[model samples]
Target: MNRGLYEADHEAFRDTAREFVIREVLPHLDRWEEARLIDRGVWVAAGTQGILGLSGPSDFGGADQLSDYRFRNVLLEELAEVHATSLSSGFSLQDDIAIPYVAALGSDEQKARWLPGMCSGELIGAIAMTEPGTGSDLQGITTSARPTGDGWVVNGAKTFITNGIQSDVVIVVVRTDPGGGRDAFSLLVVEEDMPGFSRGRKLEKIGLHAQDTAELFFDDVVVPHENLLGELGAGMHQLATHLPRERLSIAAHAVASTRVVLRETLEYTRTRRAFGRRLADFQNTQFVLAELATRLDVTQAYVDASIHALNAGELTAVDAAKAKWWATDVQNQIVDACLQLHGGYGYMTEYPVARAFQDARVQRIFGGANEIMKHIIARDLVDRPDR
Candidate 1:
């Protein structure tokens, strides 16, 4: 089916992104995977290519025309084609998750100071939200930033933080006013050079080998009061305001990753033979593949519609939840079936399918769990007396 979701400008941007990925990222994927983290130099290279910060202001050395996120969607589609989910995730974290906070909340001085560095890849940004005991429960974080005369004193720890090991500046989510309800939490910038800010062991994950995820600890890490990301006691609102973008980014990845596995499976099935007959000759295989293709087409449509809605600023959290959960669900199912089609080779790490299968498992769990997504959707659809 023809997907007319992107304009000519977006198409041009995709071409640029593809060139950047193929030249800089693809060649380095294997080495990075073996190392378990992408090299810091690549970030600088991406900045030089003008691909790192697509959504920052021109004055800040970022792409000035980043209003529409469709460019990023297309970039994910291209990267996903090569079965590089880790790379896709890293880039998405930079362009989608981190840049938004800088653009939306950072003050003029902050923007001038950070945006240029962020856009140019001189600074890698990360947001620390999930702690050891809390996942999806934002208010349950035990990390705290206590007020002081000069600034604020932050202390505690965070786990499962993406880009933790390499992030130049981490936006640490901490409780500022203990009894301030859901509003007590606030995000403060904790720089790498801070006195007591430390990154713990880089946790091994089932997939995303090239993407760094780690635990962070803070002990009397003082953040200048100006480093507070948004208004004090507005952490929930701050997170709520941009979650739709985060979810949409996940949905984009889900759809793109599905297409990648499907494409690879189709090619493999056509070439591999059983009893002198190509695997594609089997009726059952064809039927299963037909189902996958149909589902991909259907979900891709929904995802594209969601992207459009995101651009128009009308995408709701409920709709994003629907896209995030459903597309990832379909993405996982398709990959699992595709892996089954590969028989023994599917389980081997040598094949991209195996890695994708493992990596896709985490999608339903993060960016808000699939269950949480359902809760959000349910709230909007079901009538409640409490409301």
Candidate 2:
């Protein structure tokens, strides 16, 4: 399929991204995974390579490729080609989720203070939304920030935060009004050296080991009013506006990963012989690959459409939800089938297919869970004005 999603510039950018991934990311993956943390140097290298903060304004030392998401997608595809999913996840958090929030909503002063460092990779950012008691329920957030004479005092804890350990600044979702409702939440920027702020243990996960995921704590941490991101009590609205991009990023990665796994599996089926014949010669193998190839192309079409809608500033939450759930589900299905085709070798951790299987499990779980995605789509269906 000639998707025609990327122009000549995107292909040119892909060349740069591919080279960077091979030179900077691939060799260090194993070492970082063993350490359970990615080295900070790679982040800086990515910044220098103009890969970290594409959406940021150029005056702030960013690449300033704000409206074009194809560059980001190209970079993701390159990472997937080598199965560096941990780095892929971390970079997506930076480009798709965290940086966009600041770029979109931060005031000039706030932008000047944070955007330069963030774009230059001197600062890493994390969004602390999930708490011990809350996952995907922003209304249920217990993290509180109260106004004081000087500023606001924040007290809360967040878990399952990507970039938690290495984050130089965190955008924390807090309860600004004691009486909780839609208008009660606000976003506050919590810096790393802020008093009474601490981090918990780096969590061990089933995959994405090189991406630092950990717990964050804030107790009587005073954040100045200047650190406030966006309007007070508008966090819910802000989150809703930005979520489409995050979900779309996940979908994009899912499609790219499935492509890689299927490609590798096809090569494996062609070479490895059984019963005096190649595995690809078997009817069963042919059927599986044919079905998977069709599914991959179909999923890619929708996801690419979603990406275009996003670039045009027209992608809805419902549409993004559809892409996120469907693409990830397909990704998992393809990986599992391809792994099975490898027979016993699929179970071994050494093979890329096995590693991809382990990494693919969390795709459905995160980005607001596949169950929540269906709920979003279903609610839209029933609540439409035409209905």
Winning model by TM-score: 2
Question: Mind giving the per-residue lDDT tens digits that candidate 2 earns over 1-387?
Answer: 699999999999999999999999999988887898999999899999898888788988878876888889999999999999998998888888888999999999988999888887889999999999999787999999999998899998999999999999899999999996999999999999999999999999997877899999999999999999999999999999999999999999999999999999999999999999999999999999999999999999999999899999999999999999999999999999999999999999889899899999999988899999999999999999896
All candidates: CA RMSD (Å): 1.5, 0.8
Q: Which stretches of candidate 2 lie over 4 Å from their true place?
A: none
- Encode model 1's per-residue lDDT on 231-329: one tens digit a residue: 888888898888999999998899998898899999999999999999999999999999999999999999999988988888999999999999999
How does each model score on TM-score?
0.97, 0.99
Clashing pairs in 1: none
Positional deviation of 51 in candidate 1, in angstroms?
Answer: 1.4
Residue 256, model 2, lDDT:
98
* Span of 10 residues, lowest total lDDT, candidate 1: 378-387
